[model samples]
Target: MRTAYSVETVRTAERELMDRLPDGVLMQRAAAGLAAACADLLRRRGRVYGARVVLLVGSGDNGGDALYAGARLARRGAGVTAVLLAAGRAHEGGLAALSGAGGRVVEHPSDTSAPFDVLAAADLVVDGITGIGGRGGLRPDAVPLARAVHESDAVVVAVDLPSGVEADSGEVVGEALRADVTLTFGTYKPAHLIDPAREYAGAVGLVDIGLGAVLPPVAELEALQHADVARLLPVPTGESDKYRRGVVGVVAGSARYPGAAVLAVAGALHGGAGAVRYVGPAGDAVIARFPETLVHAGPPAKAGRVQAWVVGPGLGEEPGVRDALASDVPVLVDADGLRGLNAKVVRARKAPTLLTPHAGEAAALLEVPREEVESARLTAVRELAARYGATVLLKGSTTLVADPDTALPVRVNPTGTPWLATAGSGDVLSGLTGSLLAAGLGARDAGSVGAYLHGLAARSAARGAPVSAEDVGAALRVAWRDVSEEA
Candidate 1:
């Protein structure tokens, strides 16, 4: 799994590593990695020799790193120019090194002796306006320079982080640099993994500076790898029987929306469950499509034994919701079933509870605006988990799973495409995760693995074309095989 740390934690780790090393050892190491990455990029364009390299130098360590890297490029036959954002406060040693290595230094971008022309025609532009310590956004004076870089065709590379983004919260308050790649040091920052800021920070490259031993093992955010998901997947054993594998009970779909039942059952069928017992008004519709489903008309408790229950895909405030929630089996709540949900009842249940809410549903649950929930997805998901005492999966551009326990790391799904925004996709996800829960995986594992498979299936099915919710459900088996067969 790939992990990311908060800015404060990274700073602490960097300090500890620096204390044991020489004064400029860490900086030199960082500069070396940055220069190598720049050289590689320049080499890709043909040759590093005579390549125009422009560095936007600020007053921080980030700027110093850029300056030293510029010096390296100049020494290697690249035409390097440093545009200093801060004149007097710039790193003296770095400036001298760049000048000594035959690199030109320009003081800001003015109408007279401006480096705007150089920046426009440069092969590569390195953004060093701000680092992890920067808050809000870019300064007023630097906004024009940032705009100019964006308008240019240069492949922008951000040093450490894109300027004007909050490091810890992944929030882009105002103007920020959009990089083709970000070369981060020591460890991955929160901005590198989370959304908004992550979108601006295109492809991230970690430049290890020997701070691994000093950094904490716990990561604030984690993206599950193929190996991690494979381990959590349930596989049938020699001793496994129909009853032994697990049964998932789904209470979904109303007469008004029978398609919800079909989509949900479609996902449940592929979720490694031994059997699916569906209890709802759309039993006829479900039986018409999938005759294998055990259909019932009444409450979920009377729908025979089930290891896990999925309620509320198209259910319109039905009484069956109460019966399902009251059952001893693990329960997954989604769509209309999540409406007017009682937090106390969910918390009182002995079995695990998983809540799947999109931004609008989550907003209703939290009594906040939909925009608020969408903008602050991390905070909304975490808050929902704490309040309802259940595992919360907030689905959107990025899917995040948060456990009720705050100490546990939140899982962010890296797989997914914009095509997943189709209607009824969440229904499919709810059923799939419910089946996994019945198969004996914990709430967190079920949610994370289910999301992983769901997103992968969507991508595989679409393959760059527009796909419906049904296509996503049908591709589940393909996704399962792809993960299970991995060596």
Candidate 2:
């Protein structure tokens, strides 16, 4: 699992490590790693010699890291220049080191052609304008320099994190640096794993400064890896029969959209469920595509013995929605079923209740605008989970599953593609997750593993081509096989 820590936790760990170590030891270790990364990047183009390296230095330790790294580059014959954002408060030690190593300093860069030209012709630009401590966008004097960096063809490497991003929230409040690669120090911040800010942080390289031993065991956010997913996946044994393997009951589709039932059933069939019992008005349509499915024309309660239930895809506010929710089995609600949802009813349930909502549905539930939900996905998901007292999976560019209690760290789905923004995709996810729930994975694990498999399958099926929901559902088998074999 890939874990991310909050800024408070990171600072606490850093301070603890610093107290035990000698003066300048931590900073030196960080600078050495930063310099080595720059050297490697410079080597990729040709060599460190004669390469024009520009450092956008701020007043913080991030700038210190850049300045020291630049001094290392200067000694190797690279023309290193530092453009100081805060000329008065720059790191004194880093500045002296760079000057001693024969590096040039350009304080308070002008908007004129000279500074612009220097930035434009540079082979690489190390962004140290702001790190995790930065609150909003760049300062007024730094805007032009940032613009020049973006306009330039030079490879951008961010120090720790991109400037102007909320490290803890993964929220890009204002103008932020977009890097080709980010070399972060110590531990991974939440922004490095979550979206919006995560998008700005391209390929992240962790520079271990031995902060791991001091970091807290509890992470702010967690993402499951391949081996983690493999362990969570359901497997069959010699003693296992269809009933023992677990059956998933799906209550989906209507007279208007029968295809939703077929798609949902398709996803359930591949999610390690021994049998799928589909109950809805779209029974005929589901049977046509999957004859293996046990079809029922009645309500979910009458569907006969199911380990878990997936409700609401194309349900269109059907009365049977109530019956499914009242069941003593785990229930997953999606699409139209999420409409007019009651928090009280969900909270009253003895069995686990999982709510899957995209940005719009999440907005409706939170009584906020869709843009608000999209902008602060982490906050939105957690708030919804807390409000409803249920496990909530907020689906979007980055899928997040929040634990109901808010005590456990939220699970972020790392595996996904832009092509997953198709119609009926959420329905497929709902059914897949329900199957996992039936197979006895907890709400968090089921939702996360289902999302992982769903994304992997979508990528496998799409392969850069346009794919339908059916294609994604069909590819689940391949995803399952790949995970098991690879593990």
Q: In terms of TM-score, which candidate is strongest?
A: 2
lDDT of predicted model 2? 0.90
lDDT for position 23 in model 1:
94
Question: TM-scores across all candidates?
Answer: 0.97, 0.98
For every candidate, C-alpha RMSD to the true structure in Å: 1.4, 1.2
Best by lDDT: 1
Computed on alpha carbons, the lDDT of every model, listed in order, comes to 0.90, 0.90
Residue 282 displacement in candidate 2 (angstroms):
0.9
Tens-digit lDDT string for candidate 1 (273-316): 89999999999999999999999887887889999999999987
User: Which window of ten consecutive residues has the lowest lDDT sum in model 2?
Assistant: 108-117
Name the runs in model 2 displaced over 4 angstroms.
109-113
Error of model 2, residue 210, in angstroms: 0.6
